[model samples]
Target: MSKNLADLNSLEERISALEKIAENFKKRAAEIDEKGEFVYENIADLKNCGYTVLTIPKVFGGKETSLYDYIRLQEVIAQGDGATALSIGWHMGVVRNMYENKWNPKVLAAVYEDLHAGALINAAATEPQTGSPTRGGKPQTKAEKIGDKWVINGHKSFTTMSVVLDYFVVSASIKDSEEIGNFLIRKEKKGIRIEETWDSIALKGTGSHDVYFENVEVEQEDYVETLGGAKRVNPWLLHIPACYLGIAGAAQKEAVLFAKNYAPNSITGTISELPSVRTKIGELELKMLQAKYFLYSVSKKWDETKEEERELLLPQLSAAKLVVTNTAIEVVDLAMRIVGARSLSAKSPLQRYYRDVRAGLHNPPMDDMTIGQLANFSLNKY
Candidate 1:
């Protein structure tokens, strides 16, 4: 094992290691975006650095990083490459949720072992028919019980990290029942295939391909949890905004650097000295500061709050995601304005950041749902 991988025992060590690798990620960011190719090397680097297992419980031989630290780590990774950060964030968030919410222990153990062995995982929930799962649409995917095995047949869309995931917790409707369940399907299972269907302009390297399960069989025990179970708050979803915030941070850096160096004949000095440029930079800083405080504060509160009290935090959690994600988009826009037309150049990182940050809007807990929830809560409370 590499020395960096061995030293990932604490949050600080992991952060340091991620920072070291992010420079290399930045160098390849444009190429990955241009080709819309998944950077397998970036994923490998994350695994080699032990970041892939950061959310697993300590008893499972993992880092058990706190929610706050996990968000911080994600932000740092996003600074280098938003696509890589977003792709990996799904794995991290899913793992954290499983452990926190207590998924099937046996399955969790088996998956943790795979994670230690450089395997990745993510939920395959969204489907072409259901649209965003957040809208409470029943999955079109169907699972049938055949003897001791359950045969799953369905197509899952937006399966992030599809190319590399070792396991997919697929949501499917149980045949002959009104029930929906998440089945833990291994990648090596027979009758499983991935269709390279992802072609989004934003976060193009996420490799969120379409996965088909035709007569895929799993042990009944692999049926992990029922869908639409009592809703429990998930603070880990904040990783979504954390990823975008990191992209915005990268954009902010690019803008600052460009302003400090690019001297136009019309200016006495570099534009960094211009009041207008300074104002935009200041606005960028303000937005980022607000976003960081909101994200980190909520994550910290989640870490400190009791499990039973966590349900009450749903509104705040959704608000944090909403505020931070929108703030990140605004920050990137301001950053591009600071850099002028050159920011849109295919060679410029700002263009990539601009495109990547927009993906956060489409992530879980949609803006409309969050707003409606907040309104409901306010009306009831008052």
Candidate 2:
């Protein structure tokens, strides 16, 4: 088979397996959200199915899933449970980026081994004071070279998958220097504690708790990479939009199901027959198509572009994120409109989808920044 056809076949097989796992996730998603508990079992299911290691480099004995394929997998998982998909998306995307960027060889080897053994990892960069790392916030998390080991001390906010992650790629300022470096810290390290502070109304099951590192130490080899100023366009970040799109997909499914069955005394048949409801559904489909096309097209471009040339695609990448994330929010809103007031019910999945989809607005490549980049690109090109 051709490479593209082989990849397609592989993706189909993987997605089919994920669909079965996602069905179980869908059953418990509401409860997991209601309790604001981490989707431990859902994550375990992913690990058991070897989905966690699919993005590891092929040299590392992984499937080496393409960026487009990974995003599709994330969307599928999100349709099952947005929280689980969002949480795991971080691990999957980070793994892909880390390998593609070629982090410290020894460190990468070790992490890959752990990944193959079902370990999960995510970057812990957001801090209470510094805010999102995307805004060039120097981490308050400090790492000091204490003899042969580095002692890391600080708190990280929004450490998603905190309850389940075996490794944390923490960004910290190097003590007594202007440099910031990312350190790979194992969860089993001493002086590390999780503060369950993720109380957001969105993606509650994400377990985005605060992690405190009071004198946590790691070997010198764990000091993976120094932070750099240039913002390289990372295609793996597309997983974020894929996740929200998946949540919107779930909302669409629920709205359609409700419309096809919900009959009002004012109507002769189900609400699906109503023109207004049909219009909303049509709008949902339009937005979904727009978002999916934008997301997948950009991802395909990223996969096809050479490493040096990929940097030039930053504007397009950010635009894709901007379009898809905003469209996802709108799609969920339309779905809720189709479902009416019952969509706001605490028991309804639409409510959860609404909250989860809104969280995408807070993800990296914020809409305003994306617009600014597009404007700059146009002005410079002209």
Candidate 3:
């Protein structure tokens, strides 16, 4: 193994240990509603397991796992539980932005220290009117430069892990500059407030909420540029797809087991013996298989490339997210169908999978928008 891969492997033992503990919380996960009311010791256990800091570059004393390892880690953990994986997804995503932008030495060091200290980080990018960055295709929050710091005032909704996260990478427009920038808002900052508004139909434990920033203050150095200027082609955004694929694969596995055990009201045999159930299960497996390969291939493509070859890979990576997320939703829906009315219950694993995976469709550069962009690029050639 390379030095980086070797370093990242150490995290698996710790995280896997935490997953074993979190297994006890699976049934209780749906009961915890609202953002602040949903805290589990298992999440804290993740900190104890050395999970909150793996993304920092080596200069900052972080393992800086390659995209291949990072996504792989997410997939394994996600298969065990979806909400935990969804909550941690943002932390990994922002740390990736840090890598892409090539943060200043001090910035990297500070974030690394924060992570090691058990601080959870997340991205607060979606607003009520702005739709989602994944959908609207751009940022709507505003960052005003005043004095030595930028004062950010906006409302971001659906911010995952809002309760536990110590830092938020907020997407806001530059006040007078008419430009977009991401401001790192500390949870401890004076003007920032979190509204416990994330009561959803699924992924109830993710703690996604509405965050209100009534002039949150940050130094110029704290801002991470994601769009418009000096942006790095972060292949790390690929982590989002990893989260969805994990849920899909888990659901696919669950559906098979349920079919083997389920007894229909009229039929004397297990559902697995039914021809219809077998057909749907086959379809779900095929989609999951395709999705898994697409995700791994894209990550490996970049990992094997020179710095000069990355631009050539972005279109393919974007296509991977579009396909994998869509496939996951389809595959999980098929699982729900196999279970029938029982799957609609609050207790069924398929219900959460059904709702949580839809977040992928609404996730940044929305699928419709992505298709449009892809078509534009491809059609212009003909």
Model 1 is weakest, by summed lDDT over 10 consecutive residues, at 1-10
CA lDDT, every prediction? 0.89, 0.89, 0.75
- lDDT tens per residue, model 3, 92-187: 778767656766667767876878778888888888886766543466677888899888888889988888888888888886676787777788
Q: Which stretches of candidate 1 lie over 4 Å from their true place?
A: 5-10
Q: What TM-score does each of the candidates earn?
A: 0.97, 0.96, 0.86
After aligning candidate 2 to the native by TM-score, how far in Å is the CA of 269 from where it should be? 1.9
- Best prediction by TM-score: 1
The sequence of per-residue lDDT tens digits that candidate 2 reaches over residues 1-382 is 2222223357887787788889999999999888889999999888877778878888888778888898999999999999899899899888887876669888899889988888999999999898989888899999999999999999999999998889999999998999999999999999989999999999999999999999999999998888887756778888899999999999999999999999989979999998998999888898899999999999898889987788899999899888988888998998988888999999899998998899999999888889999999999998
Report model 2's TM-score to 2 decimal places. Answer: 0.96
Model 2 CA deviation exceeding 4 Å by range: 1-9
Clashes by residue pair, model 2: none
- Candidate 1: residue 345 lDDT (0-100): 90
Clashing pairs in 1: none
| Local accuracy of candidate 1 as per-residue lDDT tens digits, 1-382 | 2445445566677678789898889888888888989878899888877788778888788777889998999999899988888889889988877777678788888888988888889999999999998888999999999999999999999999999989999999999999999899999999999999999999888899999999999998899888787877778888899999999899889999999999999979999999999999999999999999999999999899998798888999999999999999999999999999999898888888888899899998999999998999999898
